[model samples]
Each structure stands twice: as structure tokens, then as C-alpha cells.
Target: MNIAYPYAVSLEEDGVYFVQFRDLEEAFTQGASLEEAAFNAAEVLTGILAYRLDHNQEIPAPSAAQPGERLATPGVEVQSALLLRQARAGRSLSDLANAMQTSWPAVQRLENPHHWPTLKQLDKAARALGKRLVLSLE
Candidate 1:
């Protein structure tokens, strides 16, 4: 379940680099170099998702990477958001709260990208959702 987003990158006439996610209309960022642009892409994607979460907006599913596009993999905060969203599909907050032996507010906070949840807490949430939390390094 890699939630990496595919984005188009271009060089502007002013020698600035631009990155945009076709799936997310609100996401766009610029940088002076490709490395910075790529970094900003991840940051922008995370920010977009966080904003949506904060405002209770719908989060669109990430599309597959096509040819000639860069992949912007979100950090742990965004990844947690994805996991929590998937875990909540077809379920109720009370159900999850009961499964995790926590309060509804706590469960909601767990899904909040602005909140920093520990891996242990995430693992517990995964188990409550009948999923396992796994980690890998590249």
C-alpha cells in the first residue's frame, strides 16, 4: 500500500523548478534546484493532506505513477493519516475506540496529521483494524 503520489516537474523560464500533483489541484511548490523541488514536493503534499484533514475535507486516493513523473512519498505523519483513513473504512469511531480501548477523541487525534503518534500507538491501532504495522528502509 505505497501511497506515493506521482507529480509532474518542470523548469520555469526564470530558472526555477516547479512541481505539481495532477491528482491534487491544490498542491504546487517551487524550488531553485531539483533536489529542493523534490523535497518541497513532499512537504507540499503533506501540507495539503494536513490542511484537508484539519478542515475535514475529502482526501483523494493517490494515483499510480505514470511514465516521466517523479514519486513523492509522504513522511510518517502523512503515512499515518493514510493508515488511519484506510483503517476507518466501513467502520465507526466507537468501534475503533473500543477495539483500541481508547476514547473517541484519542482515536481522532491518532488520525490527525498534526499529532505525533508513537509507533507503539500506531501498532495498536493497526491491530485494532486487523492489520499489521510494518516498516522498511530503502
Candidate 2:
């Protein structure tokens, strides 16, 4: 599933552009211009997702974008971590490690948002979870 979250951008009375994610109430930012606002939106989204992952908080699924709402995606590291966690689906880390033929700690690191797993590692994890890794350009 695509991991891009839908966000609404509005121009404030003071001329700043405000961006807010519907699914992530705590994620919001403002910029001086539309371009800056878009950029800030992505950064904030990534930060919030990373925070949630680090804190073991629930990561909400991205809702379908409504008309006039733009999509903001988190960084690749966050995406990879979330995807791996979702694919595991409550399976134990040791179970996944056995399936991937890797050490348990290694498998644990795959779900760490701060650790950037190689593509090969991600693909192997995906395969072990009976899923295929798919990448796309927005």
C-alpha cells in the first residue's frame, strides 16, 4: 500500500502557508510560501512518523486524498521501517529472523526507523514475510 499521507495547505491571514495532516493531528507546520510549505509538510510528516515509530505509537494508515488535498510522504527510512513492521503482522522478531535466516537483532534493526536497511535487506525481509518489495516515484 502507498504510504503517502493526505494533507491540506491553507494560506493564513498573516500570509504564511499552513500545512496539516488529517491523520496525524500533531504534525503541522507553516512556511512563507507554497513551495516552502510543501517542503515543510514532507519534513514534518517524516518527523512525526519517526517519532511515532520510536515511541511505539500507532501509525495510522494514510487516507485517500480528497479533492484539492495534496499527498506528503515520509522519508525512505521511515517508509521501509513501517512497511517491514506492517508485513510482520504481529509475528515474533525471532520468527521473522528464522525466515530470513538472519540474527534476531538484525531483524529487529529492520524495524528501527533510525537504521537504514539496504535494499537487499528490505527485499529479503519482504520475501520472508511472503510479500514483495515495491518502489515507486511520486
The numbered model that scores best in lDDT is: 2
Highest TM-score: give the candidate number. Answer: 2
Give the alpha carbon lDDT tens digit for every residue of 1-138 in model 2.
Answer: 789999999999999999989999999999999999989999999999999999999999999999999998889999899989988999999999999999999998998988999999999999999999887876
What is the lDDT for 131 in model 2? 92
State residue 72's C-alpha deviation in candidate 1, in Å. 0.7
lDDT for 11 in candidate 2 is 91
Candidate 1 lDDT by residue in tens digits, 48-91: 88888778788788898889899887777877976788767969
Clashing pairs in 2: none
lDDT of 1 at 99: 97
Q: Candidate 2: misplaced stretches above 4 Å?
A: none
Score each candidate by Cα lDDT: 0.87, 0.93
Give me the displacement of residue 124 in model 2, in angstroms.
0.5
